[model samples]
Target: MSSYLIRNAQILGGAPQDILVDGGVIQQIGPGPTVEADIDIDATGLILLPGLVDLHTHLREPGKEDAETVLTGTQAAAKGGFTAVHAMANTTPVADNATVVEQVWQLGRDSGYCDVHPVGAVTVGLEGKELAELAAMHGSAAGVRVFSDDGKCVDDAVLMRAALEFAKSVDGVVAQHAQEPRLTEGAQMNEGTVSAELGLGGWPAVAEEAIIARDVLLAGHLGARLHVCHLSTVGSVRIVRWAKSQGWDVTAEVTPHHLLLTDEMVRSGDPVFKVNPPLRTETDVLALREALADGTIDAVATDHAPHPDADKDCAWAVAAMGMVGLETALSVVQQTMVDTGLMNWEGVADRMSHRPARIGRLTGQGRPIAVGEPANLVLFDPAHRSVVDAATFATRSRNTPFRGLELPGRVHATFLRGMPTVLAGELVDQGDLS
Candidate 1:
């Protein structure tokens, strides 16, 4: 309903160009546009990219609204320059059926901040014993194309094979959490010297690798799409690389935390550093970074699990295993990947926007920044730097591990289909569209 002219923004970190948006689509791009518009944004010294897309995010709604709701989560996503995100299915009621998945989908539709695609659960209650109503959920109005038991692993070989087969029929992907529960039982942190000195239970890398190895083989055999969620270990990276070598439809994601943080931070005894497929050794982090740069890793998912302060502010062993990542994802990427000279902004857009959108089979959200494409875009000031403050975050939860750390880059504005959900580094109220 509104038209905009973004002036002198660097497209994909390339030469600067002025872009015009009208009727929710990009209308023109050049040194200057002849068309008039309601709003004109000066984007000098900023990089414009296709709005980001997260393949893994936890919008803790339906039961954990105190932690995060679709509205708040998507607002956080907008703040992070993400125009689309896949909501993981590990909710209180568990999005295992059409009714629940559709409810989540409708909530996302109402949010109006970003597109929220609901991920259906792989098994009922994430029990891993019986496959959930995958076909039914896929056919529902939610139209879930990705299924996962994210907080839990679909460990049963027979059931996992069955899920892969079922997803194949629907042209969907099965995203596996890839942790062996038995091996990680009572695990408090990454299994390493830090954990040994901290006197915490160690979560061996083998636990995650073994599951990925088995699932990749199963997917290869079934000829179905398999996505490894929050893949953390070097061994897991090797497995995914080999799977891709075989030309299997196997893809893997590395979390922003895994890319930037490490088990050494766990020594602080801070619960914020704790996470599922927990932060690994420096060697693992370096390997994950290289894998991502080389395209061995498909996308950079936030896995933005949020927990109430009460849940994360206690002793390390009893604290929740996650970090609030949505708001800080891009800054972390800029610091870890771009500034390190390991990747350029074009590569960042590919890993964060294009690949994730393709992996989730999303439409209209990850298109190129060209005339006639949907105007889902982000303007970022890479030169800007600021100290992290969780208090300023848009998410309902304040569990970010980057709190107090200075991070590079900032999202100056984010447009969703030509409407500014976030402008001048602040959120715009779209009003209730539900």
Candidate 2:
């Protein structure tokens, strides 16, 4: 292992301090006399944070490798300053059982960029018909702790109840996509004044809010852990807040795209702006941000769905619904939350790192930057700004909605277990493309 000395970095935006990382752990932190190491970084104006964690990322490997692979997706995550991400189970083989989940988990281990915890599918084939082998996946080598049918909804009440029971039995959590299928049969974008003007099929906000309301009630009745994924509507936020007020075991996450983007982008007729529980109204965007800052929302997830150009670069009616987000999440958060004075660096660390890790039950990835703790860290220059260019990103896909938008902040370096996965804003040990 290599030793690193990061000099005069602001830890969690507190007083500047020198941090010494050795043997995969933080060895010392404070004003130091002088330290010798294999690498010395002059971090005079950088903010050092506990490495970011994503509770909801779509790494389309095993079957959709043309879109993304575990290796490339984790590389993108490192560039975004994430040390751990929970890979959503919405792939070709649909990681519902032990064997496939284990395959994805091993691929993450081999990637060496960041930690990837596989989320098992809540239903077989995500059809919402039969419950998948939840306990078996939890007992597998992958040790799956989060289950979700992300691209689809588990609308069957009896089946959802059983899944919740299974999660409660194993101390895991069931993450719901929160969309009522009947209400959103052919939804193209958010249902509102914009949709009316464009003459496109609209996805109603109640479709999401209704599912979240039912799931929150179910979780309260069962006393089981439940997590809402990609919450976008103002009504959903109010319901989640009410659920927390009642002391239910319910937690919710908002995506970085939802925090900043709106349905107004759909006016451009670009499929890149389309997403599941699609980009909402500006009012909903503001409400989601306030909820995230006030702790009504628990964490920030990337929902980092990737798709080939053939899938996305088409007519709106036939285009795929997603945007590549792993490489741009932190920058989006900084623009909408920190720079707008809605949140500080400490709140950013909690929402992006500590809380997401806790929701995923990950013990090693989100530890604080103190002596004897694992040195999973990110050094970010908040003063830096850049216009995004998807062509230069590490991910395989180029469907980012922020393609030419100027975003605040940049990741200088990211360390996973004291190893530099990204250094000086470039991927370390980038091997063959073939």
Candidate 3:
């Protein structure tokens, strides 16, 4: 059986202890004896977390391999300390059915970097018209538990309600992109002083907030799970908080970009900063931080949308709306949430790993750092700070807005099932043999 000894790692940022993994399970925890092992890591001074899990990652495969593939995207996830990532359903020919999702799932299994759970589409072709065969996708080998049209919203109230009801039967979550198409017509950046000064069309906060309000009510009424993706504005947070206060089955996620960046960054006219649910104001950023720390926001998903250089290098008006995020997610969170004192390492683990896994219904992922649990884990160096370099990313695309920015924290190593996918901050394919 494969075995590993993680020596002197601080579990959940607590006291240092040795952890032993045998045959993909945590066989022992505590001051374990140092002995022969198939793999051993000198993890002294490194903070160990349950392997991070991202509920929203766009792998862009099966058609957009020019941007990203299951292999490269999972490589980015592994670099970010994520053991699992939910591949969004917006691929070319869209992952709206079991066949497409299974293909993505099988690709991830073959990659051997991170476990990729494919998010099936909520509608047939994401057209907001006919509903996709949600049950078929869920029951397929992919075992898709989350359904979303993500790049588009299910604006038809009838369709939204029907999706909620249908999801109830199979216990699936319907995650929404939450943009009101009418409200965001021709929108370019966040609707505010910056957009006015820059003479660019604006995406209003109300556009996102209105949908969250409607969908949370729909989800509550139907008694099904609703997940709000990449929540950006203050108004959206308020709606999510109210839904939670009422004990409705609704959860919200804020991306790393929204938590740290403001719409003002668009003033530079750099297409790299452009993203859907356009980055909001400083006030919104602070509120998002508070909401996440207080549990009003459930998780931090890296809306890891990777676009090739040609797509993102165009003029602002025509540039694609996304930024590659997986490799930088943990660093941004460490800088914005932990270093700012809004949350501790344990809180980061909960938001980044535990809650996301639970939301996606991933049994093997997001397990606790304890005995008898799956040995998916990350060893992070909080003291490590490095400059952001898109050129060095594992992703095929380099549309990151964080380029040239210095960020704190680093993933020293990431282990998936007692095998290292990344060791000493570099990728290795040896884990496939395990």
Candidate 4:
């Protein structure tokens, strides 16, 4: 069996320690060497973290390979310190069935970079009409346990309730996109001072809040698990907090953009800022930061939607609603959360890795970085700073909003199951894509 040793790395940015990996599991972790290893990594200045888990990511494959394929997306994920990411089911054919989900899963295995858990669609082709084959997907090789109508919402209450009911039978989570169709129709930016001045149709905060309220109630009534994706509004946070106070099984995530940006950027008319669940006010940003700090938001998901230039490089009204995030998620989180003293690195691990894995029902991920745990971890340099350059990304698409912006920290290396997928702040070659 292959073996490796990480010497003198900080455990969650703490004091230095040594970690040994063998047979795809952590053999020992201590202040000194426990066993000899074939590969030695000098992690003298690295902060060891459990490999990140993103509950929401768009790997536009099976149709839009020009934007992002499973291999390229996983390459981006490994560079971002993620050992596993839940691929959103918003492809051309849609991953509502077992076949597509298994294809994506096998692609991840072939890539050998990160574990890609497929989120089966909550509706057929995301039509929001009839339910998809959730049970069959759950039993597929992919073992899909998370379902979402991500780009769209399940607007019908009856259908929503039914989806949640069926989800429980298979121990699955229904991640609602949480946008009221009527409320957000023709939406451009947030319904606020900026968007009003810009003369674009506003995406009202109530649109998101109303759906979250309905879904949480349905999940509570049905005793099913519900996850709110890319939660944007302050009202949404309040509702999630209230639902959790009521002991409802509702968890929410804040995207990297939502945590650090506001809709005021929309004034620039840049399509890169025109993400769905449009960025809200600075007030909303602060509220999201507080909610995430206090655990009102269960995790920090990338919502790493990728799109080709032809789709994104156009007028705001015609452009796609997404930004490539897989490469910059950790840095953005570090800047907005850790350096700001809103959260510690340990808290970052829980929000980015542990809790997300638990929410997605991913058994092989989010385990504690201890002896006998799967050797899935990332070595991050909290002190390193670099300018964002989309040209350097492993992802095929260069839709990153952080381009030309300086970001703090970097992922120096990543290990998945005792194997190196990235090293020296670069991807470790696993052969070739073609």
Candidate 5:
């Protein structure tokens, strides 16, 4: 390990200051600190923030190696300025049991790219029928604090209530995908004029809102916590807002794509624009942005689903549902939220880093850049502009929709425990990549 000093950097939308890091902790943050380190980074015009944390990320390990692996996924996360990401348990072998969950956790630790917390599956194999070994997974070496049936909805009310009750005993949260399977059966895209015109099955707003409404009340009744994943509709936002007002232990997250893009992008007939809880209307997008700004939404997590090119290049009806989001999350946030005056850089840090960390219970991540805090940080060049190029991505999948789109703000460096895991937008392998 080496020491470093980031000089004259803007600290989380604050004034420019010098920060010193040694032994993986911030030693000082002041004007012209009289300290020396093994390395010096002249971040004169950069913004320094606590490393971003993604509460929802799919690593696709223990199965699906052709799409992505823990090593490649974490590398992509590091390149995106994330110090920690909770890996969704929708892998090939599903992280439903202790053995699989611990394997995923150990792989993340061995990779040394970013902190990976495995989210345990709420149901066996995510079938939404039998409950998984929740207590066993929570007690495993992974110490799983979050359980979810991410790719599928835990739609059975009794089963959902049971999961919520079980989470209460372990202080864990049940993160629901929030889509009513019946309403979304064979759903192809957002339910509106566009889907009707394209002859595609519509996924209506009520499908998501209905599930959220049920789960929040269930959580309140069970005295447990519930988190809504990738909330996409205005009605859903309204429900989450009302739920919060009612003093329910409920938190919700919106993906970067939902915040920036909309159902209009699907008009191109590109599968890259397809996503679960599909891209919504402009009104929904506006409502979600407002909700995120007003604290109705707790965090902005990247549902960074990656897929092989063959799986994503098909027709709209048959294509995969997701986009590669890790490497471009901050840029999208800067373009959609910060630059639009809806949020500042500090708010970006909060939504992307601090809040997600708190929601997922990741202790060493999302800390403020102050003396004695862990040196998990990101150096961002706000003025830098770059076109999204999937060919250059660190992930194995090239499913990004932002290709050739000019995006503002670039992640210059990401330091995990005082070591630069990503430098100048490229991943630094610590003997992990073959």
Candidate 6:
């Protein structure tokens, strides 16, 4: 790869400076550059941030390839300014074993789009009965440190406790889906007036809060780390805060959708608004935003779950419970956090890139833009605005809730190890990696 200089961009979360990249590392970042490069990007009005890292992304590969492959999902991730995304382990074969996890890791390496860290399944087939080979998966070629039963909840308290205890020895964290299955069975939307009026079974907030309350205490008891996924309720935020007050080793993430949209969108009867731990009330949305602002939430993750059109374009009760998030995560954050005065670009970097990287224990990622740091970077035009067009996305699925919605701050370019994965807001071709 040739050298490049990103000149005049406001380096978010860093002192004002210019950055020069050579040999896939940031070589110099200062006021004046005596060096020349093959390319020099004029970034006069843009903000430069570390390439985003997502701890929760569902790149459905090795099985649900029709919905998303590592290539397409990471391409979308690049478009959203991500340099790495931890791929969830909820595929058809279930990435519970070393072979499957390593295969997925190799595919991401071969795809050459973004760094893909495979998350191991917390339980065998996510059954919550038998523990998957936690130590083996952690020691696999994938070097998986994050384990989760994301699509299914680890509802059995005894099993959850055991998993937490086992993870403590390996220094791995267990991310829980945090839904009480018995309480949310057949539930179509958030448990509130809307669901009641729609005559749909409500998924009560207590269901999620109940599980989180249990897991944090379990983590405290076992001296293990815990991560809560896609926290969507106000009550859940209070529990996480209380856990932190007790100094429990717990971290939680909120989805971009939960931060911006609400269950009232479900009145459209559009499946796009349907998601797991379903969108809650406007009050819950405000609480999530405040939690994110006040540090009660650790990060903002794109639960970028993809599904085929047939699965998502159906009735609300039967529709899939996710949206394609990789392409819109940063834009939504820019709208909800930056533009709203709730956070600055530095806070955005911490939540979207730095903190998430730490959570997944990604060593080579989320570094500050400086000499000798890896050239994982993004040039963001905060003033830019556009409507989200799902048909134009790089992912195989078009299930985003933000379709036709106007969002701000487009990603101008994203560099992964000094190679342009996205240039001028468009995905560049990644040559075949044999």
Model 2: pairs clashing at backbone N, Cα or C within 3 Å = none
> Which pairs of residues have clashing backbones in candidate 1?
none
Local error of candidate 5 at 112, Å?
0.8
Global lDDT of model 2: 0.93
Name model 1 segments beyond 4 Å from true: 432-434
Worst 10 residues of 1 by lDDT: 425-434
Better of 2 and 4 by lDDT: 2
Which portions of model 2 show Cα errors greater than 4 Å?
A: 430-434
Write candidate 6's Cα lDDT for 1-434 as tens digits: 87888888899934556789888899998897888898898888889999999999999998999999998998899999999999999998999999999999999998888999999998999888989988888888899999999989999988898888877887788999999999988899998999999988999999999999999999988889999999998899999999999999999999999999988998999998889989999999999999999889999999999999999888878888999898889989989988899999889989988989988888999998778999999999989989988889999999999999999988999999988888888888766211
Q: lDDT tens string, model 2, 1-434?
A: 77999999999888889999989899989898256887898998999999999999889999999999999999999999999999999988999999999999999999999999999999999999999989889999999999999999999999999999999998899999999999999889999999999999999999999999999999999999999999999999999999999999899999999999999999999999989979999999999999999999999999999999999989999999888888889889899999899999999999999999988999998788899999999999988989999998999999999999999888999999999899889999945211
Clashing pairs in 3: none
In the range 1-434, model 5's lDDT, one tens digit per residue, is 77888889999878889999888899898998786787888998899989999999999998999999999999899989999999999998899999999999999999899999999999999998899999999999999999999989999999999999998888889999998999999899999998999888899999999999999989888789999999999999999999999899999999989998888887888888989979999999999999999999989999999999899988777888888899999998888889999999889888988888888888899888789999999999999998888888889999987899999988888999888898767787786222
For model 4, what is the C-alpha lDDT against the true structure? 0.92
User: Residue by residue across 1-434, what tens digits does model 1's lDDT show?
Assistant: 87889999999999989999998899999999897988899999999999999999999898999999999999999999999999999898999999999999999998899998999999999888798999899999989999999999999999999999999998899999999999999999889999899899999999999999999999999999999999899999999999999999999999999998899998888889889989999999999999999999989999999999999999887899888898889999999999999999999999999999999998897789999999999999999999999999999999998999999999999998888999999998776221
RMSD to true structure for each model, in Å: 1.1, 1.7, 1.1, 1.5, 1.4, 1.4
Q: Estimate each model's TM-score.
A: 0.99, 0.98, 0.98, 0.98, 0.98, 0.98
Q: What is the lDDT of residue 101 in candidate 6?
A: 95
Worst 10 residues of 6 by lDDT: 425-434
Per-residue lDDT tens digits for candidate 4, residues 1-434, read: 56888999999989999999888899999988857898888999889999999999899888989999999999999999999999999998999999999998998888889999999998999998899999989999999999999999999999889899988998899999999999888999899898779899999999999999999999999999999999998899999999999999999999999988888888878898889889899999999999999999999999998888988889889998988998899999999999999999999999999999999988889999999999999999999999999999999998888898999999998888888888898898886211
